[model samples]
Target: MTPEIAAEADLVLTATRAHRADVVSLQPKALKYTFALADFAHLVDGIDEVPPAQTGFFGPADDSFIGRLVDHIGKRRTAIHPIAEDDADIVDPYRRPPEVFAQMAVHIDAVTPPVVRALTLE
Candidate 1:
């Protein structure tokens, strides 16, 4: 995405690690908002109070749930980085066997709740 588009976004969630370089490269200012999907999942997992999945949509509020979550994650960012870097990518399951797909699904499943929770937090 272009820097303008990235700037407009409240958050940028990449599907995989492969996509992160492109997202972060041209848009240095977006670094705080952009996150690899799995990396974000990992970051949100340890937080004690991730807003529940019913706060509201991303915008139109005084402060969005995602904005709050991002702020919280930013505060704990240094601690979150080292542990997440190595395994922050979800495995690509394209053109793979059912077993491989299942493994990929499992990883996605593990991360989904935290992401949902963060987005939904009030």
Candidate 2:
């Protein structure tokens, strides 16, 4: 992605850690907001529901839930650890065998619930 695109983004979610790094390299300023999908899901687990005002989403409400959510997740970055390295990133299943693709699906399944729950928390 271009630096401009990254700069304009509220959050960047990639399939893998390497992809997240690639985006970060293009926009170092986005490091705090960029994350692998699985990694972000893991971070979301540490967040406790807070009022909009607490997360800067109150009053006139100029901020989005995602923007505030990202801030909360970013704070938990050091607090959560994946049970395994695989938990932090889903394998790129492009041009792979059915078995490999299934593995990727499993990894996605593992993170999907928490991620979805967090997104719908509003």
**Clash pairs, model 2 backbone:** none
lDDT of 2 at 115: 82
> How do the residues 1-122 of candidate 1 rate in per-residue lDDT, one tens digit apiece?
78789878878988676677788787877787788888887788856674433344764432566666776676677875444554667777899888978987888898899888767655
lDDT of 2 by residue, 1-122 (tens): 89999999988889988899999999998898898888878778645673452434444532678777876776576676554566777887899899999999998998888888888888
Q: The CA-based lDDT of model 1 is what?
A: 0.73
Model 2 residue 42 distance off true place after TM-score fit, in angstroms:
0.7
In model 1, which runs have C-alpha deviations exceeding 4 angstroms? 48-62, 84-86
Per-residue error (Å), model 2, residue 82:
4.7
**Candidate 1, clashing residue pairs?**
51-121
TM-score of each: 0.74, 0.82
